[model samples]
Target: MPAPERLLPYWTIAVPPLALTVHFLLHSSAGPAAAAVLVAALLGAVLSAVHHAEVVARRVGEPFGAVLLALAVTVIELGLIVSIMFGGQPEPTLLRDTIHATVVLVLHGVAGLCIVVGAIRHREQDFSTRGAQAYLTVLLPMVALTLVLPNFTTSLPGPYYTATQLAFVSASCLVLWLAFTFVQTVRHREYFLPLPATTADEAPSPAAVAPARPPGRQSLAALALLLLALAAVVLLAKDVSPYLQSLVTKAGAPAALVGVIVAAIVLMPEGMTAVRAAKKNQLQTSINLALGSGVASIGLTVPAVSLVAWWTHTPVALGVTPGGAVLLGLSFLMAILTYGNGRASLLSGVVHLILLATWLFLIVVP
Candidate 1:
């Protein structure tokens, strides 16, 4: 199909919200399970939009376009999720755990799957194994400390978890996210560097790297837009969440619906990137972006939301439940093994699928 035709298919963005509307009208009330599905579909649409933008950027050979698209989606997705979170009865620690989950999914699962698939398909190791290893090493300890351990103990609020404790966790996650982003930024710089005066191929010089913007201007712009977007999402969520949460509380829906819905909303854009990359044979970059976004989502999104909760004096839950912790640990381990060697195999892909299935099962079973 032509590019024009491809663009038309992206209209699927309309599906998610429409589905939510239909759900609202028909049921006049929906449960968490339904809500979760709706949210996931919505997020998937968002992810698809980002992936499409990246495709256009790739065709045009414009990295800036990709960066802009990523920035836009990141802001939008975070805005929507945070808004919904605040709209509901406050789950302070929820933001932290969700962020942790997103990181785990990205670092170990999505990255591992991409590497494994790409390696197998290309019949060669053509990607960055070291990057994957470094990511997992840092990710595992951080998650174990911040998420898994906290779930089992209730000493979190006053003693083991104080104002300082929360700040440390939130800041640590953000720093980790920044560290990963730095890696990508550095790699992009390296790629754009001068090939040296001795190079034989005569070609026009690649465009000069843009001058750095002042930190103040960038920070102010980010803060303003983020505030604006978050406010908008919060308004929408306030209208939506009470009804949704009530439905769940009243036993009209399953309890596990919350996680599913939250996952869908955040993971939407990511799924789009993955399928598109697989089709394009650019699976490595796709994996990198998908997993990268996931990590960013967990690391960045949680802290930002948690800070909001803190300001509002809401409860924040950063740790996974005992069962959830176990599943997450196993998932992380499998992901590390799959992507550790920088090579992928069909079997590795199957392992990730299995892990996802396990996650779903755990969420659904009481």
Candidate 2:
């Protein structure tokens, strides 16, 4: 087996609580310079969160590790959003904007960055085409049922679904994600595993790469730290939301940009981990991380939000605007072609990045 995992950095142990304290007690009253420091601490927490998560993931194993990290972050984010929604009059379009931004971020930004990083380093990278396809297949339907279908439904006027229709859609997303998880971790586990590199320079031997898991005690420690970091992250992001909204408002940017900022902050750890995996030529693992984040964002967030909205008698919107639908359509179509061949190149990465840029530009111009 490869060398045992590295020692846990001290910052990893300290940043979470520091961020939590700063977010809760001091953030609002801080001056501009202090605010910058707080933002730095926030970013430090994100980096440390990824470090602890990687420790836990290595202790666990491939796709399962990714799933654990994704699910943990999503669950926390879902709780934060729900708590905020229940705290006051919730925005009807909050769920839609957040979910749409997540999908867009993953499909284009995260995946494209991974591809570009890996391809630039190694000329091209290979992953399990089946695995990529599987992610896309499940993602398409979930997006359609939750985002697109609501636009056309007549049971309720506008983009709002009737009670029965909402329940059906939520159930459908949950079921689809569960089935995809089963296939990913159990039935076709190999599909998500990293493909062997053809050259020694590209990848070390399997044993060299798969280091022995940390001892039981270390594993437990890592798990605890992971939870702590994630908890702190959610709180910090929630605190940042109002400030972010204010900035966007001052700039006269679209309201949707606020959701994108929230989603991006929430996803920073996962995106960082995925990009690192790509830099190491571990494209399969990166794809698993990127696509897995997308799948979990919708599959988990929708049902949780739906239940809360239903219980609170809160109105929620699920449908995207025509501009959003076009972006979604283009993103999915590009995903199909990108993963269709099991190979990724610099060109593919650049194309996807352009699409993401188009998305950001449209948000401002449209």
Candidate 3:
């Protein structure tokens, strides 16, 4: 059994529920200052929950661990998006903007930071090229078909999809995503595994490596906590949305700024974990987390929101603006180059960060 102190982190599991109850009881009359404090507390609780999820991921091991982390974070992202969508008058463009922002954040911002930090520290970090190729192969087309093609299609007036197109496209995305999931978890799992170290010095330290087997009871507890935390986040997100929206509005920020903030909040835990893995020279794990989260955000989120839109008779737009399309294309090209050689350098990181900056700039300027 692990030491008792090692389990101290589990105490955080109670925070989300407590925070949610308190917010519900108090938020109706809470002023802006009080709301701000509540938002901070909620964000902190979410981060703590994310930490617990990371601990669980470590115990689960490899490809599965990455998948678990991706799913956990994606759930948070989807929950927030869904809650906001249903909370008030639906913003037709909100889903599109949020999805676009999420892809950029994960594929560019988070991934870039990880690569830069890893490259600067290790000088060069290597990961499985096959793994990246698999991700891009599915990701590029999905992004193009879902986010880009909608603008060009005559099947729908404006950049919006008709019911038929939405159904078809949503189903296609889900199918493709499911197929990719099977490959990652089953067919070619080895492709995602870390490459063998070339020398003893390159090998991970004993303490840094995962155990041969994780404790079952501990794993179960962690899983329970993860689910509870996610539920709390979703439940509380409805209350948090108004404060987030007001903050952006008061600053005279672009409407898309809301999407960016939501994406950043949802990606925080996964991004930190990925960056830490990169710093440890576990670039493969970092790559998996970054790309996997991006994939899940798009693949899972679009279909989900589509279903909701259909049920509610809400208008859903999936197309990127012309400027967004161009930026998205550039980001795809950058990702291809970044992962092309199975190695990353500071230059690669810089290019991605530049693209991320462009995306953010366009949100405000365009």
Candidate 4:
């Protein structure tokens, strides 16, 4: 049996159901003040669910842990996107903007923070060059084909892909993502493992060491709870969608802001895990979490959304704006430079962070 302290994370199991009930009972009739309160409550639920996800990840280990976190976040992100996509008023650019924002957030925001913090503490951190190369190999082409190429495609009108192009792009992304998953988890799993400590001083702290997997029952319980918590997040996102739409419309905020917000919310668990790993000089884990989430976001989310668009006969935009395309290209370039040499430094982190900030600034000005 788990300790009392360990069981605390299970509280997330209750959050979603409770939040869902509350939203259904009161959200429609609630005033702005109540809505604000509901939002805060839902946000807390998201954070709590993220905490539970981290606990579960720690029990699983390595590339699998990162993969689990990515899938969980992706599920929540997909729920939010689909909810909004089907919600009031058509926003054709919503999916594209959200995917673009997700890429930027993972590649630059989360990855940059990890690199900066790790480099500042450790001077430099070592990871597998092969792992980084593999990620970029799949990620670069995935982004270019799905996001950039659409802008220039003569077959489509105004960054919009025809049914044939969309089907091809969707299938291509799904296959590439599956190929990368096979390599990461099966064939080349060792590539993502943390480097051995060279000197006595470089040894990982106790907390940094991989924890033993919990017993089978406990692990199963954790998995069940994770699914429940994820379900709650999706339900809560649905409740929040109306408010978000209202706010965006009234405030005249850029549609990209919604994507950024959703990306940040979904990425929270993995982001926390990545930063912690980086701080402990576990750069490989950080890279895995950071880049893996990016890959999954594009690989999985794009296809799911595209299919939904097709089913509903909604006009979907898959291409980036000119400025978005340029920023994404730069982000990809910086990622290569940062991880090209099998090591990371403060400068690399700084470069990526600057790119992230530029992307954020453009949301308002663009």
Candidate with top TM-score is 3
lDDT by residue (tens digit), candidate 2, 1-366: 223336476777778888878877855664566556656766776667767777787778865776676677676567456644544434577788888998999999999999999988988888899999999999999999888888898878758898888888889888888889889978998888888768767666766467666677777877887787777766665555555555778899987776787578667888887999899888898888888888888888888889888898888888999888988999999999999999999999999999999998988998
Clashes (backbone N, CA, C under 3 Å), per candidate, total 13, 0, 0, 0
Q: In candidate 3, what are the lDDT values of residues 273-333, reduced to their tens digit? A: 8999999888988888788877887777888888888999988877888888888888888
Error of 1 at 332 (Å): 2.0
Better of 1 and 3 by lDDT: 3
Candidate 1 wrongly placed segments (more than 4 Å): 1-71, 107-126, 149-160, 187-239, 243-256
Q: Can you write out model 1's per-residue Cα lDDT over 165-259, one digit (the tens) per residue?
A: 66777788778866655565555434222223223332224431232222443334333433433333333343455655666568644444554
lDDT of each: 0.54, 0.80, 0.79, 0.80
Quote each prediction's TM-score. Answer: 0.67, 0.90, 0.92, 0.91
Model 3 regions lying over 4 Å from their true place: 1-11, 52-68, 206-209
Worst 10 residues of 2 by lDDT: 1-10
Q: Which ten residues in a row have the lowest lDDT in candidate 1?
A: 191-200
Could you tell me the TM-score of candidate 1? Answer: 0.67
Candidate 4 lDDT tens digits, 134-197:
9999998988887788878887676888988998999999999888988988899887778889
Ranking by TM-score: 3, 4, 2, 1
- Model 2 residue 40 distance off true place after TM-score fit, in angstroms: 3.9
**Clashing pairs for predicted structure model 4, backbone only:** none
Please report how far candidate 3 places residue 332 from its true position, in Å: 0.8
Q: How high a TM-score does candidate 4 get?
A: 0.91
